[model samples]
Target chain A: MTSILSGLESVKQALASQQFALSITQRNVANASNESYTREDAVFADVTASGGAAVSIQAYRDRFLDFSIGQEMQSLGKQQAQSSALSQIDSIFNENSGQGLQEAFSGFFNSFSSLSATPEDLTLRQQVLSKATALTSELHRLCAGMQRVQYSVNSSVPSTVDEINSITSKIAALNKQIPGETGSGNEFALRDERQKLLENLSSLIDTSYYETESGSITVTTGQGGLLVAGKDSYSLESSPLSGSGFQGVQLGGADITSTLRSGKLSGLIGARDQITGYLTSLDDLAATIAARVNQQHAAGSDLDGISGTDLFSYTTVSTGSNSGAARSISIAISDPRKVAAAGPSGGPGNNENANLLFAVKDEKLFTTSTETASQFYAHLIYRVGSDEQSAAEEITTQKSILAQLKNQRDGVSGVDMNEEAVNLIKYQKAYQAGARFATVLDTLSSDILNLIGA
Target chain B: MRVAQSETYRSFLGNLETLNERMNKLNSQVSSGKKLAQLKDSPASSAQLIGMRDQAAEIDQYQTNIDSGSYFLGMADSIFNEVNNLVTSIYAKGSQSASESVTADDRATIGTEIRSLRDQILALANSQVLGRYIFAGSRTSSAPFIVSGDTVSYQGDETANKISVDRGLEVQEGVPGSAAFNSIFSAVDSLLSNVSSNNMDGIQTALGQFASALSGLGIARGEIGANLGLLNNAKTNLGSQETSLKAQQSQVEDANMAEAVTGLSQVQTALQTAMTAGGSILQQRNLFDILG
Candidate 1:
């Protein structure tokens, strides 16, 4: 009698295990479209010497693949951010629309040449002033655009740091909950949530994380700086880079801007430097142009019979300092009658001065080196275009890599509806078979009992 | 390997975005007829394109200069022809009046004709074009020749004002009044005085003076003719140069319409194919479809 009861207990435990398996399959089929949900499996084990069963459900996830995704996602984030910023710079000039610095500059110089052709043509003198205004305004527009790009990068740093801190704290909270749930019950859903969080964190900044025995995760920077240890998360702060409004990232009161290798934060930093570098070049070009043009202009005589003075006024005349000369430059000589065209006050129709200014277009006056103004401007455009093009291509390549990594991860963790359906039917059939076996055992025992009684 | 539905969707979406961007780029090329809509499309080419454009613009300015130079030369050319004609008339009348057969009254009558020719030559010396005295050299605002009683004086400077026709090449706007007709006027004045006095020997000597003056005028005319020729050749050369520069600029900037249209359709076909192929995978139904 004791043996029969033990056998019935074993059969009942097996039926419960099959029911659990069916429920797991049902969960998988229901969550097939959920990107955050990983497929679960019902693991069965014999608990008694008489073959009694017990069940544990677990999620199938590859830790190495998660680490690869974390690393790959960081790069994709960086390239994406860099590309977005560079393209913003590209659009500001509008090259094809003829709304660019190049056209303005050439127009201004060409106007000078036109004046040289008919030095006494009052209409052409006013045209010179118009072209000068256009060129100066375009320069200011470009300078302002560069400032805006820098300001944008500087402004984004704080928000990005705040986002990082928030994400890190959430990861810490997830870290606290995952171990507790894993120790006492099924942690499949919690693990899925934690994985999603890690991927999110990776996009903001490069990170490394590992799972402990209790299923808790320890997070750190890619370079091994502790970010989150168990349930404690470190926070990042922003500090002024200089007396200027520009801010740099700080972790534990030490700037980690240079240490940041991959992610949007690093991309923003790189882009800011790129914009500043371009700003310096523009200032240099402006300074050299102003210096040379003013010199030639001052050597000639104007319609007012005064010897030429500086044609362009600016905050600074220094070329190498790059101290915002482009933004500051404007026409120093306002009176159209004050425009110098005579060589040494020779006569009104001489036109030697305007010719000198027109010659500035092809002269090596834009740099201390031998590059002409047009050449320098062309070089600047080429540099900017190259930077943008490279960034975009890098983003594409990084994105493809990230996608490949994601696909690899999804292969192991993703649920197939057809597969889940088969598992559901399989478990259901096994449940039915177990019930039939129990019924047969009951019938045999009852028949034997009747015989004994007779 | 198992295809994750989310990943497939994301990949298809990315591919579609890429195709769409390409389509938009080709559309821009077709619409604007420019291949380089942005600098980053091709950096080196963009820089080269701008450089060539600058060169073309500079060439245009030079062309304008050439046109103005040609007009100035034309003015100088007509003035020199007038001076040459005056020199020829002075020589013919002086030689006929110097012969012994001429009567006193006839010589007096020839004196008046000669004086009229002298006045005409003086006026020609002070010729102005477009309100500017072309013979005044750089002093273009005022006439260079002055008449006091019977004698003419040249007040103009000796400098022949030059205008640039090309880079480093210059042509004089007009010859100085002193250089072209100064000697001719004095010779004509002397012949008028000789005819008035009825002195045949003085008249013969004045005829020789008229011959030399005409020769001097002929030399100045030749120089003016040569300068005019230079201006013509410069204009023709500039036109041909402008033609070549424009062609190069077009090559750098303009898109080949035929190739662009063909490529546009090809890209469209490729996009359609990609969509169809991606469609087949994403359209695979769940188990419920088969069960139903």
Candidate 2:
């Protein structure tokens, strides 16, 4: 009877061991599609050789793979953020489109060339006037575009700060819950929730994680502000910008003054400060050109033997108290009869105006190293072309770099469907074998019990 | 000593992509034929280019003014010369009348000839260019001079029209018609009056005035000639400058077709090789064969 009971106890131990193996296999099969799920194995150990040697199973996991994957995800997130920002900037400039400020400048110049060829033609003069108008209009358009971009970026600053605050709060709440729930070693759900928060936090700003002694994470922002500590979250208050509902996040009632280093927020600030600054300089250049040209045109003789009227009036809206709102500029001939007569004495110094016009055709106007408007324009053209080429080159280089990084990262972390499918088959077969082993052990135990009863 | 295949591929691909992007950008710049695509491309450059373009435009406008001014001055010079010739013919006829052997009728006939020359001079002074009085300076709506009885009065401003020729350079293109021709007309008027009245002393005085007027016209003509010469020089210089600018621009921004074609071919070769290698790697990984 004691032998039969011993046999029964051995059969029961075998059955329990097979059941534990089957459950582990089933868990692996179920989690095959989960990215974060590590392949778990049952660690079987013989119970101290007493009472016919019972068996126990322990779940095994590799922590190294988990840490590696987390690192790769962080890098991938940064690359994605940078690539998106660059692409946005590139599209906004749209340099490939011919309808840009450069084309407008060229058009204005071409009109001048045409006017030069036929100085006496009223039609040509009118064409020049129209071209000047068009050029100025284009300048205004570009300025307005840049201004719009700036305003949009400024508007987004407060909102992004608010988002950061809210995300920090959420992460803190999860941090408190994760530690308590993880004491029983069943923090899978808590970990998933924390990872989701982390992903959201990364999109807003780059972050770092500090693991506590109790298996909970303390989240910190790029600026080194404590986001989550132990089980308690430090609250971040949204400081409203004056009467506006625009929430500016303050860490300790002090403004977060550090410029966002990366992410969409950084992109916005870059566009507002750097890109818009360049555009404003361009406007200054346009203003200088108009002012200088107008001065020269005013000094020069027209078809008439009169002067002092500006030829090209700048259309800038003055921000001063006494500003005139006139938009049109007149370049009238002072002496129409003189133009008609084709006589030398009809003009000053026997057609000196004609000589003046011809003299301006000299290369000195363009090649002079002086900071004059003419030379400025020449340099401007050269710099703009070169800058555009370089910027585009940089964009391509960055994009290629990003692609290569993505490929490298993907090689390590990207899910291979074919590999997963194979894993699914292997896990499924292991699960079936474990279940069959449990069934065989159960049958053996039942047969032993029947023999003892007889 | 050694480079990883992946690292080499990434670097080469990155460089190739960068070169391709640069080429595309250059092609766009060339095709657009503009130096600035946006304000950010080169703020200084864009600003400067706009200004230069405007300057070029303004210079062209000044040139137009100069051309018209030149034509009017030329007409004035020709008219003055014609009046001078007419005065010389009248003086010759007056010389014949002044001979002691001549009859009273001959003197009257010479006076009539002198009157006609004076009228011709008056007409020349009132000559219009482009429907405005050419000799009237700023007051172009009216004739530059008025003739009544035996005197001509100036009727135009003293100021000449000035225009910009180049940077830091401006030239007067329109001499007041009063200065160029009205004074000459007044002298001619006095000479005609003296010749008609048959006063030998007055005639002698009038001959000197006529000579002075002729000299003034010659001076004005010389000034016009000098201005025309200046204009020609300016045009020549401008043309050369424009040529050099174009060449420089081409050098900086324009692509060499031959070089671009060669580069494109090289990139294509590299791309083909990469694709072939990628394809082979993909083909070697077969889960079905492993499973079987």
Off by over 4 Å in 1: A47-53, A97-99, A183-186, A212-214, A222-224, A317-320, A366-368, A448-454, B90-133, B146-178, B181-221, B286-288
Q: Candidate 2: list runs displaced more than 4 Å.
A: A1-140, A162-166, A169-200, A230-248, A257-259, A275-454, B1-59, B62-66, B178-183, B258-284
Identify the candidate with maximal lDDT.
1
Q: For residues A1-454, could you state the per-residue lDDT of candidate 1 as single tens digits? A: 3466676777888888898888888888778788878878788786452664488887878888888888888887787778788888888866645558878888888887777655655677788888888888988999899889888987898899899999889888888887767523357787787788888888888888887776678888877888898889999899888644478888887778878988888888888888988888888888888888889889988765579888888886454475779989999877786677666754545567777777777787655667898899889889888998998888788777877877777788888766776777778888898899799879888988999999
User: Could you say which candidate leads in TM-score?
Assistant: 1
Residue range with the least summed lDDT across 10 consecutive positions in model 1 chain B? B158-167
Model 2, span B1-292: residue lDDT tens? 2112243445555655655665665555556655444545554544444444444455555455456546766776677678668767866765666576766667777777777777787788788776656666555666777867667787777645555444445545555656556656665566566666777777677666766766776787787677766666666666666566556545543456566566656666666775677567545643545765
Worst 10 residues of 1 chain A by lDDT: A179-188
- Interface RMSD for candidate 1 relative to the native interface: 2.3
Candidate 2 lDDT by residue in tens digits, A1-454: 3454454455456556556555555654555445444334445556322344343333233234333334444444443433433344434544334344545555554454443333445665566567667766766665555456556656766677677677667767777776666422245545655665665666555566767787777776567777677666665554544632333456666655343455445544444555444454555656555554555555555555445355445444454311121222223333332222112233332233333333333334332434543354445444434444454454455455455543443344333435444554664575466467557666877897899998
lDDT value, residue A263 of candidate 1: 88
